[model samples]
Target: MLKIVKTEILKLKRYHILWAGIALMLLSVMLTLFTSMANDGSVWDFTYMIEQVIKNNMSTIFPMCITLITGYIITREQKDNTLKNILTIPISFKQLLVGKLLVCGILSLFLGMICTIFTIMGSFLAGFPGFSVGLALQAFIQITFVNLFLYIAVMPIVILTSRFSSGFLIGVIVAFVYGYCGMFAAGDMKLANLVSVKK
Candidate 1:
């Protein structure tokens, strides 16, 4: 398992997927800081500010990052025509898929936790005036749980896409559309409302 994880990490070195998470974390922190500063220190209008921060960051960032990473993980081997070689190795298909999913899920969850921690720390540093360590920890736990659930929910789709998709681009498009678009379409009737409004 350690070897599999290490190999996966090495594979990520050539990809922008890992960096996307870091960039998003930095961007979220900057946004939070700017928002607080721009408000002239009067943005304390909620009891769960840290929780709000986590939600805002995750909702805005996680979908795209997770999709890109997961999509690439599913498609990279196909793009390089290495899946055949990988399959011939002494590993079960289930193990390969599960190992990849576990590694990617851990990476995503770790990034999410780091972002949440930074947000809370940034809030405190910006003198937001209501920084509770307990609240911050709670927010972290909640965001981590959400991240894990999202990862598990999407893992099967990724594996299925990998098994059947003919090309990298097709796989990526399918994964992104299904993972992100389907999510919005299922939850937000606003898209339908907007279409009807336009009509």
Candidate 2:
């Protein structure tokens, strides 16, 4: 199990997925900073600003990025035909799948923490009140837990897609479509409420 997990981590070392995750974190930070500045530090109450930022940005970005990474993690192995080799190495399929999930999930959580830290610092530097280290940690924990659950829920779908075709593109498309549908449905509901309000 340990060896399989380590191997999975090593495989991800040179992948563009890590860099993409970092870029997403940076982008989230920049957006949060801009919003804080624009609000003149008054939009969200200080105590809740960090929580709001985490809820808004991480909930959306983290899941999408993790789903992409998870797809690539499995699909890349299939692409190179290395999955068969790995499977022959005495590792159970469950171990291999769970190991990969752990490594990818941890990486995703690390990225989330980076974004959380940036938000906390940016909020403070912007002179937003109610910045608490404890609260920031709480928000981080909340977001990470939610992301972990989402990753688990989506893992089987990703694995199934990869097993079918060994096609990273297809896996990515499927994951994105799944996520997009959920988000779109939520947005449609919100819009319906607005339309009803104006009626």
Candidate 3:
């Protein structure tokens, strides 16, 4: 499994889809910055900025973004005609799938860090008040863990899509709707609890 994960990482070294994922991560921060321009007179600070970024992550960006990327990775074996070669090496597709899932968990953490960096940069650029080392550290930990949990939430979709060729495209659509629903759920405690367990 470790070897499979390492090989998957190596394959991703040149994978252009990663750039798309990074761009999506950047889009979350960009959206947060754009929201900061509102004249509603609400005070904006580092902590609030981090909160909004995490909100956007959960409500808009991370779930679908990670799902899309994970789906691509899972289906690539079929897309590139490499499954046969991979299977010939004495590994079952089930094992390969598990390895791919593990790789995605790790990838989610790395992307989380990237998102944190972008959030901090966005905060600085937007002139958010009350910046502090403690807040930054808190943001880092929160965003990174939130990403991992979000990835976990979307894992079933990735696994389902992996069973079909190019099914990840469908997973992307499902993930977007799935994530968007969270915004509505958060408004009601009952709905939020139901949705939390549903995921």
Candidate 4:
């Protein structure tokens, strides 16, 4: 299982999937920055900026990013013509799927860290009022974990998409809606924090 996971992670080293996540992170921060122009008199601080990045990640970016990345990795087994070779080694498709999913879970954390890095860069670049070393460190931890949970929340769609060759795009759509629905559930005490708490 660890070997399968290692293989899956190696595949990602050649794939540019992280670029998509980075792009989305930048866009999320930019969108938040654009909204800040409304000037409602809210103080912009490192923590506040982190919140905006988290909001965009939970509601817009992380879901589709992780799903699409996972789906592509899964499907590439067939596309790259390696599935047959892998099966000959006595590794079942089920095992392969599990390994790929596990790798994606790890990938989600890496992407979360990337998102946090980009958010901090965006904050400093835009020169939004408040920033302190302590605030930045706290925000990094908070935002990164939030994004990791956001990926976990969209796991079902990732699994669903992995079952088909042409499901990546569909998975992206489903993930977006699923992530967007987090907003509705977030207000309910029962469902709020469900993403972070559930598997």
TM-score of each: 0.68, 0.73, 0.96, 0.90
Please identify model 3 stretches exceeding 4 Å from their true place.
Answer: 197-199
State which candidate has the highest TM-score: 3
Query: Which ranges of candidate 2 are over 4 A from the true structure?
Result: 34-42, 92-94, 164-199
lDDT of 1 by residue, 1-199 (tens): 7777788777877877677677877676777566655645555632345655554454455544565577677667777888889889888767776677778888778877877777777776766666566767776886676666655655555666666545434544544444434335534577534322111
| 68 Cα displacement, candidate 1 (Å) | 1.0
Q: Which stretches in model 4 have alpha-carbon errors above 4 Å?
A: 188-199
Which ten-residue region of model 1 has the weakest summed lDDT?
190-199
lDDT of 2 by residue, 30-119 (tens): 666666556454666545566555544533455566767777776676677777887788777778878887898777677767776777
Q: Which stretches of candidate 1 lie over 4 Å from their true place?
A: 1-3, 29-47, 164-199
Worst 10 residues of 4 by lDDT: 190-199
Clashes of 4: 0
Candidate maximizing lDDT = 3
Q: On residues 10-38, what C-alpha lDDT tens digit does candidate 4 reach at each position?
A: 87878887688678877888888887778
Ranking 2 against 3 by lDDT, winner: 3
> Of 3 and 4, which scores higher on TM-score?
3
Sorted by TM-score, highest first, which candidate order results? Answer: 3, 4, 2, 1
lDDT of 2: 0.65
Q: Is candidate 1 or candidate 4 better by TM-score?
A: 4
Give the alpha-carbon lDDT of every model. Answer: 0.63, 0.65, 0.89, 0.80
Of 1 and 2, the candidate ahead on lDDT is 2
Q: Scored by Cα lDDT, where does model 4 land?
A: 0.80
